[model samples]
Target: MIRFGPAGNGNSFYEAGHKSSLEIPEYLADVGLNAYEYQCGRGVNVKGEFCRQLAAKAREYKIFLSLHAPYFINLGTSDPKVMESSLRHIAKSLAAAKDMEATRIVVHPGSVGKNSRSEALARAERLLAQTAAELMPSFPGISLCLETMGKINQLGTLDEVIGLCKLDKCFMPTIDFGHLHARDLGAIKGRDEFEEVLDRIASSLGAEVVQNLHVHFSAIEFARGGEIRHRTFAEREYGPDFEPLAAIIARDRLTPVIISESAGAQTEDALAMKELVQRYQTGEGGRDV
Candidate 1:
């Protein structure tokens, strides 16, 4: 629903003991943010009655919920045990998300170790397909989104992720604009390029998918291939260009949940993006003015 949000708990401004994931939805609600992505990066630490309470609270506040699976996952691993473990984690994360009434779960496609890129991608696809089949019955409403990875060593690419989404309707692509920019070493030059990426996604998965996009954005540093680390929006020199992205979202009437991943300044950046989107929607800038 064109939701703008931060990656983790929005209460980073609060003291450590004063904040918890359960308190985030209400805080975000108070701050005018309608969406939140629960970060289970280390593990899905929130469980049982706590999860159910959080779900109820999120519903009470009308906060749109999503989850990021643990960073330790590697579905493309050559070892079957590793793959199985990844699957189990995904299944558990999905259950947690279900309890929290989360709509989607974002996952990394895993690294390309000794295998060739294509081979790794195929392996990831098979593993994800199998995982989806197993989870479909239980988490019927949750969509599993494979995110585009920034580094060259990782299996995810825009095309590769789109291909996986095409394989199954339940699967979708979470386009990380910072990662795309880093992956290409700042190739997304302007509005047209941004539009083209969205066009490609629409072409691959149909226009309806654009209506509920799961997106991540920030300024990033990259070396040879792409993505070294995230930077604050103000700190970025070379970029994935937010203005053009804002323009595209305006022109296309796209409704995406944009999660800001700016290092240590996520809430501030998210608010800035929301303001930009609102301005774009209302035609406040020179071209429209």
Candidate 2:
């Protein structure tokens, strides 16, 4: 089954009177979501006991779990100190994900910095390969998901992410559609564009990878530099609606984990996406849900 949920607990989660992250699994289950991506973007400070508790709760609630690693991890960094820190961060993240029984952990490939895109990508590729060599055997159950970044200066375009995924069978691409849309200055207007993305991934990585994809979707605002901010679905002015993608997903019978990162209203937006996908699955494809 295709999974739909928020990247983290949204405002309504708190408004519903839940005070702890441990409560999120039950809360998500109650709200009709079947997946959750735990945020560790700042740092991996979660205790093993807490992760064990969360894991149990998630299993009981039938919620699939994923983790987002630190935002500061820079695999392309020239500095030895920075590269060491990046490896440590990935190690800690994998450890935490293992404790949580998370199937995958998402990572950013880092910025281009002063180097040309090719040079930066090469550096990131080598470092990621090295990191995988050291870490993959220890965390056999967890997949490392490299994300498509939002900024043009970043090392994670769709092609870049796909290349990284090819470095290891255990690696996967976290295709963030909103990031692609923003980075291209709203190039993904509808189904044709979305289908092109899917086609490219399928052609490059084969059917299994495309069918069981890891995805991030959101409405976003952008400037020339790329993603300005994530916007709620209610913000109708944002480009790249989810309906087109939902239709394709249903049509292809793909079972991807689609996480919403729509500002503070992610849960509601995720629910909307779920409904949209269901409608398409039921053969009710149209502009209207």
Candidate 3:
């Protein structure tokens, strides 16, 4: 089923807090959010017995779990040692995810650094393919989701991520609406464009992928290339129409997990999005441009 929730802790209920990531699930449960993403942006904080305990608690509450690996990883590094280190980091996260019973692990596709985009993408593909080949047999239950990055210099794009997913069934793309909006400089103006994106994903990876979609939504600011920084949903003025997105989600009956990344207002924004989706589904709201 579709799971709508905030990006981080639902319990702590604030954006910037020093609470341990393990406590997030219980807080999410109390807040009526059915999913939580463990952020390992710095590193994997939960491990050993604690990881298992968190997983069990999540299962008890019927809260789905996912993970975001360390941001320092660069899968497209030109140096062999750097590439190997990146692979090791991903493997570490995967092990933690398996222990925690997380359904997916979101990864940032590496940067172009000094190389050309094509060169970076090619290197990234090789590293990812090798990593997948090595771990697929052991981590059969976990899916590696390559996120569509907001920055132009990053290796991720809708086409780039989808192309990489073609190499392995265990890999998929995490469609971040905010990232897409930033990438196009606020181009997602209407329902048709939003629907077209969904259609493109289905055509590329088949419709089943839509059922278990892992998504992130927020208001974003962009410049010449794409993505300057993230802003609260209310702060954005140009556009990334959530109303049209809600309508599409209801019409297609897609079971997506939408994680709100709206600065520190994630919980409040998530609730608003959930309410909007419900209204659209029940035919209580009219479509707004």
Q: Which candidate number has the best TM-score? A: 2
Each prediction's number of clashing residue pairs: 0, 0, 1
- Candidate 1, residue 248: CA error in Å? 1.4
**How far does residue 151 in candidate 3 sit from its true spot (Å)?**
0.7
Tens digits of lDDT, candidate 2, 66-176:
999999899877878988899999999999999999989999999899988888888898888898798888999789999998988888889999998899888899999
TM-score of each: 0.95, 0.98, 0.94
All models: lDDT?
A: 0.84, 0.92, 0.82
Q: 8-106 in candidate 1: lDDT tens per residue? A: 853364744446678877787877788888889998777678889888988998888899999888977889898888998898899888888888999
TM-score: which is higher, 1 or 3? 1
Residue 55, model 2, lDDT? 99
Residue-level lDDT tens digits of model 3 in 42-141: 8776766877988988898888888888897897779889887788889889989988898799999888889999898899989888988897668988
RMSD of candidate 3 to true structure, Å: 2.1
Rank by lDDT, descending? 2, 1, 3
Order of candidates by TM-score, top first?
Answer: 2, 1, 3
The top-ranked prediction according to lDDT is 2
